[model samples]
Target chain A: MILNDLSELAARIPDGAKIAIPPSRSGVAIAATHALIARNARGLHIVAIPTSGMQADMLIGAGAVQVMESAGVTLDEQGQAGRFVAAVKAGAIRLMDSTCPALISGLQAAEKGVPFLPMRGLIGSDLLKNRPDYKVVDNPMADGPDPIVLLPAIQPDIALFHAPLADRRGNVWIGKARELMTMAHAAHTTLVTVEEITEGDLMADPLRAPATIPAMYITAIARARGGAMPLALEGVYEADSAALAAYANAARTAEGFAAWLADAPGIAAA
Target chain B: MEYLPEELLICTITRLLEGTGHIAVGVSSPIPGSAALLTRALSNGKTGVTVLNSANLQTLNDGAGELFDRAAQGRIGAFFLSGGQIDGQANINLVGVGQYPQQDVRWSGSFGSAMLYYLVPRVILFREEHTRRTMVDQVDFISAPGTSPPEVYRPGGPYALVTGLGLFHFDKLRARFRLTSIHPGHSLEEILDNTGFGFDYEGEIPITPTPEPDRLSLLRGPIAAEIADPYPKFAAAIFKS
Candidate 1:
């Protein structure tokens, strides 16, 4: 029932926890991202289920300790290391060579309290054989013939996201209401960042609420004013080119990030 | 099959795209990438066409989301699509059978299947091989189709089928497959090794011209030239971070 500050909440999730963060652009929960960046945490392995090519690039550019990335599209127009390329090649990041399926499948597995979840995507792709990190366990519930794909449970210590609106009880709304719905539902502990955090106004038009990320499922509800929505919808503010530039430079490495942090004292982009 | 269908698929698709009065494409779609590049090369980049790069940033001139809708209002212009699997009636399914549906599959097969297929006069179905598998008797699902009946879309069916080994087309009347061209260095037997269905061969299947390797190099080079900031910029951001 007690809401907290953004930086204060992000710091609660101890370092070295496998964190799941949305990539740049599409509905990426930026309030949570800034929370992480603001904390100046290190050795955190972040999983990014991508949306915008540019935004994802920025996460790597800024400082996503490890990227469990997949899907969307190959954003390689020039094939040169933007920020992601430089990071991966330098061993600053590891290539998952997987997509959205991996991210979602893993989450669902964790939510169900099961060892892994069976998914149908990525059958023929070499991703099955190559990634030693992902184990394909055989499904016991499968029918007579074919082998099913079992994705390992991904119980990231925490899940941070933003909803369009929320009530005091933490009822959430995902504007167009996307798989983000499932993600919010699956995380063991959920934290929501919202544009409007009001119970009176939200409950007034109760039917207008998106999915309610029940108060019990939620840990913290913080309000960060003018949070960046890099790929904000029609009426929303466009992606922050300035903030992205700052992250782009700062996230080069832990050391480079320290200097970038030293410079972040009064830096704020609207 | 490292870049197996690169050159052959590029030339075949672009030649079919010869008629697009105005065209726009996505990032790194080798066929579209090459077609757009070739189309621009043909006119020396003088065409009034608008290009949409990977970043969803429209270059030349055009608004977001309007590109797909614009291509629908056409005659004889071409749209490029290829998949690991193709069934009869051509409804390609890129996304998984059932992944969260919306945000589940990253790049679901053909987003605007009938939406554009119905509007565009010619929809070229392309892939690297003709194996009975890829060129199946009928697709497991229809992601996009060349034609449906009247009170429907363009029943004319697919305009062209470009494969790694050869090319084929749907007969306007029969709506069945017809031999159109054979790629160089590939024999009719090699072609037969690919397709799963049967089609009449007139023995006049022309040898498709192999595009110069110089052309394919543009995938990461000067030609691809940041049509959209989404792709390369996005990719760079991902790996580097």
Candidate 2:
């Protein structure tokens, strides 16, 4: 289904929904995130595909997140994620601290329709002790005593991200951001915001077909120009570092964060 | 020749990455990334570098999981890791200080450190801040352990640790860090005063080698332009002159 605007897309993501979002470097649906905040979506469980950045921080700051599961949340060179740090310190949200490959492997298990996937490492880390769901068992194939960690499958209610292009047919082009594809496969529904809608079929072109996500997996699409503002969309644009720096500075305090959010370009414009 | 602290750190890291076939740098690592690139250039493209999040520098095209998969297959030769707290045993805490879940302080949770530290052969631990607060006697939480039990299926572990002040080599068998060399303009006393953990050192500790004139030129020239695409702000600030 083609959504009229980002608000409609945000509406589909109900309160308390488990939503999977890509990292900052990948195509982040910042516009849609703004719409969710404007709608006052609450009690959201955010599954950062492996990690996250400003989008997660903004959501946490807005009190929209109840649980955050990821390897980490940082603002790249801009330093630590201010809101994320504040939230964790205040014990505002439940944090499911995991390694990058652990999250990815969990999602991959869901995509493959498996109960769990075995992985090496995490033998003596506190992360294993904290996560009760992750089990350590003897490797049956090994001749000697060999142990490995098993991560339970993670299936989110929705996978949301922005992309460079999507056809009227709802086929979205993700290019080399294949992790988005993994997220879509592991989620119950996939929502996307794109820069433009083309008339031609994306899969028809041999060159473009490899990177395109078929419409069958994508539940809805919203046309959002410069949707990934402040976060770059690979070939389309570069990240607005000045704006990110401003956000980092403003988000240091609760009142300052509120003021910044209220006057945010997308939220105020809406 | 006079050089910035970051430049010296980069040169030190480059020396550590001497003959590592492929060096993969993780997120938010400008110095190691630069050093990897410098190593590649110095090796005349013999050494491979894969900087995460860089379109031009990254060679992995499969997906985010590909990097880990490659490491598991023993394809990635060297990688970098840092922590909120590091101990004498080389155990790192990227989680936070105090306790787990509900801690007084928290950093961006543990990244790919747990797995990468185990999979990659030469894991170079790098942290800019070298203080008693950071270099702890024991990490509050072991985000990734320095060494695993002998029976565990582990092929790799910490090779060395580089800080703004000096360089230390991790003795995996002994599970201890030995002070290798202090950086120029810094002393053994300064290291001792700031360090919370103890380390082994010979009678006369040597100073870390300064970057040669040619290496400085490479860093300020082609390498700066290459790294600018991913870390423009860092490149601009460091290579401004």
Top-scoring candidate (DockQ): 2
Worst 10 residues of 1 chain B by lDDT: B96-105
Candidate 2: C-alpha RMSD after superposition? 1.5
Interface RMSD for every prediction, one decimal? 12.5, 0.9
Give the Å shift of residue A24 in candidate 2: 0.4
Count of clashes, each model: 48, 0
Clashes of 2: 0
Number of residue pairs clashing in candidate 1, backbone atoms closer than 3 angstroms, sequence gap of 3 or more or interchain: 48
lDDT of 2 at A203: 91
Report lDDT per candidate. Answer: 0.53, 0.91
Residue A160 displacement (Å), model 2: 0.6
Candidate 2 chain B TM? 0.98
Q: Provide a comma-separated list of chain B TM-scores, one per candidate.
A: 0.72, 0.98
Worst 10 residues of 1 chain A by lDDT: A72-81
- In candidate 2, the residue pairs with backbone N, CA or C atoms under 3 Å apart (3 or more residues apart, or in different chains) clash, namely none
